[model samples]
Target: MSVPFALFTHCGIYEARVQDTFFVADQPLDDGNGNPPAGWGNPYQSGTITVTGQRAVFHDDLGHTVTFHERPGATSFLKLCA
Candidate 1:
């Protein structure tokens, strides 16, 4: 088994990629909170993730899509999830 590649952002979006699976979130990834955000059963659940070189694509089950572009020295727009 391969370890998932994790990407932490300052905006509270924690992402991980393993094979063709992907997980992303805007809050802490956990199940401690019984009331998780809509669509997400857990805080950091996997969704549809796709990567092509420096570009990453995340498609949420809630019809939302997030895209990330990797660049050198790019300032992060996300903050650590509390």
Candidate 2:
């Protein structure tokens, strides 16, 4: 299923929808300025993500799978971000 809902961080956990975006596990946990969470790695990447129902799958450029689960965040979306 395709969704504009890609590139989301559910409860502080990042999920890429591959057709929408990507994520790297070893990337910095934070930018080093208490940037909080959900924001990590390069905004542009080589891999891709796929989302099915409540589940998401990530794959690198080399076809390597990088899996991360989604958690429910209490935060709401801003007008601009939404």
Can you give the lDDT of residue 39 in candidate 1?
50
Task: For model 1, state the Cα shift of residue 58 in Å.
Answer: 0.4
lDDT of 2 by residue, 1-82 (tens): 4233323332333334243333323232333443324333344334555565445665544444445443344133222212
Q: CA lDDT of 82 in candidate 2?
A: 20
Model 1 residue 81 lDDT score? 48
Model 1 spans > 4 angstroms off: 1-11, 14-42, 71-79
Q: What is the C-alpha lDDT of each candidate?
A: 0.46, 0.38
Query: How do the predictions measure up, each by TM-score?
Result: 0.40, 0.34
